[model samples]
Target: MTPLPIAAPLTIAIDGPAAAGKGTLAKRLAAHYGLPYLDTGLLYRAVGRLADEQGVDLDDAEAAGAVARALDAGAIDEAALRGREAGELASRVAAHPPVRAALEAFQRAFAADPRGAVLDGRDIGTVICPGARVKIFVTASAEVRARRRTDELAAKGRTVEYERILAEVRERDARDAGRAAAPLKPAADARLLDTSELDIETAFRAACAIVDQAPH
Candidate 1:
């Protein structure tokens, strides 16, 4: 586990590339600490799904922003949000600055709560909570991530070509890294966790260790 340095309640920002196991780590950390967990990627997924439902063009920034503003947190369905259409739309809508700005308050408010919160996404440390005392950037090689994702999909009975998934992963990475608003990059102070070979339990423990050693 990553040792944390927090003395008291503090937000833990976990940021990373897709399939890097950041989400899994964040959820476990939040559970261990009895804190809230925010999968910020779901926010974009929700907005993108909403846009699709309303027939709003993915490239239309104004339309995407309008959907983003009216998004209700309670309406998000995890299963529905993971559909291929929604995932693609999310990639497109996530590029809009307005959409990101509209969703910022919800994420920030959750992090500001008295109970410590763990937020995982591309820019949680850099944009969502720069003041976060414990920021961990969890990442793995693209090839490794692709293999994991492919295996996961297969295990879930979902048919996906590994090469195609690999290509999409690279494309998403490029888009995320190129976005002007909250691009996927580690904060200078964030500890890097290269979990290309670690399992979720090992990664969680490593992350917990980082939190334990961090100064609150």
Candidate 2:
């Protein structure tokens, strides 16, 4: 695919629930547009992992906020922050207002890149970059998302039950959507893309179309 022409700084914010394929779409869009991509959810996951490693109570806002403040976003071990555990921990820590505030600056800075950037997370469009040039809320049915997540983990040699994964996916969705701090929801102006039946290639092409049609 040819790189899209970028006449000015363009920020693309992709927000969605777990395993909704937003992360993959964001990375592809970033590459297509020659922009930097940031998986903002990893920031929260890193904080959660650090807090757990330090034996801090995950529910303690003060402790989690401190972890968030001290996090080295660039130094996060992406390999370790994958799978069900990290996702649950991230959801827990992300609900704390202080934790969200501490990490907000980093996301804002990343979105301010002069060239361009693509950020994907629960609240990228609603909170991190409300004024982003393009905002996409990519989603799929809970069952589909759970199946994808289960397959992903199994491929990594971790045996997981579909029923349990589905339940966990629903639980995470409830927690994420109910959280007082930056609850997961589509931005008012964000275009919605339901990827329940679409493959990654189709989703990427659809996302690119959204970006192309948006006012630059």
Candidate 3:
């Protein structure tokens, strides 16, 4: 007799503030489950970067929507979007209702991929993948998040100040949470993984435990 194939619809949705280690944890969980992974924020950054190239105002809903719909997720280059300038523009474009609607379909399609997927973003749990099998909202204090982001940038020789990063984090948090469309919040049933007191290893373990207990 031949061995049977086993399939599990394990979609993990992770949402958190910037530098809260959610992205890192999401990758680990994806690897553990042998699922595809997506950093959805990059989708917005790709649109923002293109908008900048075309000189389209990030706040122009019509133009932003058109640009976002015209873009493809496969074109996003993660290495190209690691910066504050692009992030700011992404946030601005993200605030537009049409822009979010334009990208929403792409995200949904990825989440429903046959192999399963783990998505990490500010609104993954609350909005993008609300029906995901496992939802984890990873977070940390502003100071702690700032420290992590600062260290990450320094490693790449960017040399930005901790204070500036802290301020930017706070501002971004406010913008994300206060936005009218799909705000950055955890689903009511989602589990919280605070990384303020936990390292990447500990956080990943907790996330794995959450997935383990999830009913297939």
* Alpha-carbon local distance difference test for all models: 0.89, 0.93, 0.87
**For candidate 1, what is the TM-score?**
0.93
Candidate 1 lDDT over 68-182, as tens digits, reads: 9999988788877764456667888999998999999999998898877899988889999998979999999999998998998899899999999889889989998998878
Model 3 C-alpha lDDT per residue in residues 1-216, reported as the tens digit of each score: 998777467889999888888878988988888999988889899999999999998778999999999997877789999777788888888888899999888888889987789998877777788888889999999999889888988998886999999999999999988999888888999999899999888878888888899987
The clash count for each model shown is 26, 0, 0
What's the true lDDT of residue 4 in model 3?
A: 72
Assess candidate 2 and give its lDDT: 0.93
For each candidate in turn, the TM-score is: 0.93, 0.95, 0.93
Descending-TM-score candidate ranking: 2, 1, 3
lDDT of 3: 0.87
| Candidate 2 wrong stretches, greater than 4 Å | 1-8
- After the best TM-score superposition of candidate 3, give how far the Cα of residue 110 lies from its true spot, in angstroms: 1.1
Q: C-alpha displacement of 173 in model 2, angstroms?
A: 0.3
Highest-TM-score candidate: 2
Spell out the clash pairs found in candidate 3: none
Ranking by lDDT: 2, 1, 3
| Reference-based lDDT, residue 59, model 3 | 77
Model 2 collision count: 0
